[model samples]
Target chain A: MNLVLHNFFRSSASVRVRAALNLKGLAYEHVSYVLRKKEHRAEAFLELNPQGLVPALQLEDGTILNQSLAIIDYLDGQHPEPALLPESALDRAWVRGLAHAVSCDIHPLNNLRVLQYLDQQLGVSEEGVAEWFRHWVDEGFASLEKQLASDARRGRFCYGDTPGLADICLFAQVANNRRFDVDMSPYPTLQAIHDHCLELPAIVDALPEHHPHAN
Target chain B: MNLVLHNFFRSSASVRVRAALNLKGLAYEHVSYVLRKKEHRAEAFLELNPQGLVPALQLEDGTILNQSLAIIDYLDGQHPEPALLPESALDRAWVRGLAHAVSCDIHPLNNLRVLQYLDQQLGVSEEGVAEWFRHWVDEGFASLEKQLASDARRGRFCYGDTPGLADICLFAQVANNRRFDVDMSPYPTLQAIHDHCLELPAIVDALPEHHPHAN
Candidate 1:
């Protein structure tokens, strides 16, 4: 199945979809949009996705799938070999809870647009923006560390032995954390899981530095 | 199957889960937490969910499910009679995309914690906090209005005639919007869908006012 990923190199959400596609061993082309240049907000891109968000996967049949988690879910359904979620309903919920802890709780507050808003609209200093970024990460990662460290179900990844949805989100968020110098000492479990994810070629290939448009 | 919901009455996330449970006809007990009083952040509540977020669903088997969408997905999987998502993978993606548009994009930014951070931490005044809230709601609703208005699959609800995931999220968001006085005039489609959701006993019963501990 042909898929074209419309994304930016630095977007954590984009990192998620790219890693999911690579994990599933699905070949897809990249249509890079430089978000800082307002390329994603262009009329043509907006026509494709009303949300105008990065990491919109245009399927072979031209259906534009938005929302990173939703796109990942679709990929998991269409290609189930390397399952992104576990088997049981409860297990899936467990994985999803981990994923949302990053996606909904952390990344939403620290994404580029929100930071830009903090810098421009709120007149926050550069240091203040960095502080805001680290604050949310610390809030999220502290609990994530506690949860992962305490859970018996956790293996090398957030779920079982394999990397799945939670791992994808955790990997992306940790990678993004580096930009703001978020101290990782508090989240040993999260750091270890992130380190394990880095060993996988699929995940490493999806990192920001590995992207074709990365500066 | 005994189930208990740990939640706050006015939380948009809690409202989503309550509506989902009602839609699935699943009976669950409500354990209220006043977010303003830092009740959800209490040691006892944090022990149940390390993330310390409300709207956690505890099953009879003692499995606690966090994240409103994940909890809803779990309910949909276990009780598939009134399915929250469509059958096909692509259709499910569309529904999920709409749901995430609210859950991930809109609600995450405007939730109680984020607003408090803006008010107390950033020192954004009352008017500024309200503007900040409306800013995100408008940004999300504009694209949502465009997408829903242009989609043919939309019916009385966000999907077909049934109240599904998208409608649950949209309903809760619109309900929350009333407190901030968001102008619904710009989103006719969303306003109409929310109005339809209000007519449903399942959805209506999930409103904050119906909660036993509601102020």
Candidate 2:
């Protein structure tokens, strides 16, 4: 079956799916959309994804899957050699809980669209937006720091030794955090896991700079 | 095995998990946390969940599962009689995509903490918060309406004849929308599904007023 990934470089959500594909060693044709240019807003693109968002996975039969976590889970289910979710249901929930802490609790608040809304609609200043972004990152990371530090299952990665869905999500968010200059001193475990994820050759290839649209 | 749910009556996220538990016909002792009073922030509560979020499942084995979707998924896995997710890989992704659209895109922006941050930190007027809340609900619902309308799989529920994760999430968010007077005219399909879901005895029993804390 053929696979196509319509994505935008430097988008944390898109980076997440890319990391999953890389981890599973799945090859797909990458079609880039430049979000800043409103390329994602084009009628044709919106037809593919009504949300007018990136990181849509188009299957060979033309089924389009939206939402990074959903797409990642789909991929893991289809190819289970290196499972992204844990073996036990409870352990899987624990790992996914951490991933949601990043994706839902932290990233959405600081996403590019939300920041743009704050600036254009609410007239928030650059400093104000930065503070807002940092506020959420700090709050989420504080809980993550404590949870990971306390979790008996914590390994070199967010779960076991392998970098699973949690690690992929955390890695992507950390990249976005660095872009906004958010302080990372408070999350040593996060930093270490992110570093370990980056050490993987496949994950390195999925970094934003390595994407075709990064130029 | 004994089951206990720690939840908040009015939290949309918590409501999502409660709806899931109700769907599985699982019996659990309920422990309610009042967010307005900062009861969830107490030292004892925070120990169970570092994130200090409501709707954490404290298992009979004393394992705590955090995040609404994660907890719901764990229950679905353990029970498996009535699946929250579909059997086919692709179908499961579609349902999850709809679920994420609510849990990630819409609800997080209108959540209590975010609204409180706007009021306390950014000095946004209550009117401003209402507008902000309605804005996201409109944006998210517009796309979701388009999606469910366009897809051939539309049934009595978001997926099929039975209510599942997507329906549970939509029902909770629609309840929140009504609370804030967010106009629901634009989403007839969503409204219809929500109305159908409320027709179910278990689902109706899980509504906010049924909780002991609602008085």
Candidate 2 CAPRI level = high
Model 2 C-alpha lDDT per residue in residues A58-170, reported as the tens digit of each score: 99899999999999999999999789999988889999999999999999898888998889888889999999999999999999999998677888899989889999889
Cα lDDT for residue B3, model 2? 85
Error of 2 at A147 (Å): 0.7
Report the error of model 1 at residue A11, Å: 0.3
Tell me the spans in candidate 2 whose CA falls farther than 4 Å from its real position: none
Pick the lDDT winner.
1
TM-score for all predictions? 0.99, 0.98
Q: What TM-score does chain A of model 1 get? A: 0.98
lDDT of 2: 0.89
Q: State which candidate has the highest TM-score.
A: 1
Per-residue lDDT over B1-215 for candidate 1, one digit per residue giving the tens place of the 0 to 100 score: 58999999999999999999998898999899999899999999899999999889999988899999999998999899899999999999999999999988989899888999999888999998999899999999999999999899999988989999999999999989988999999999999999999899999999999987799
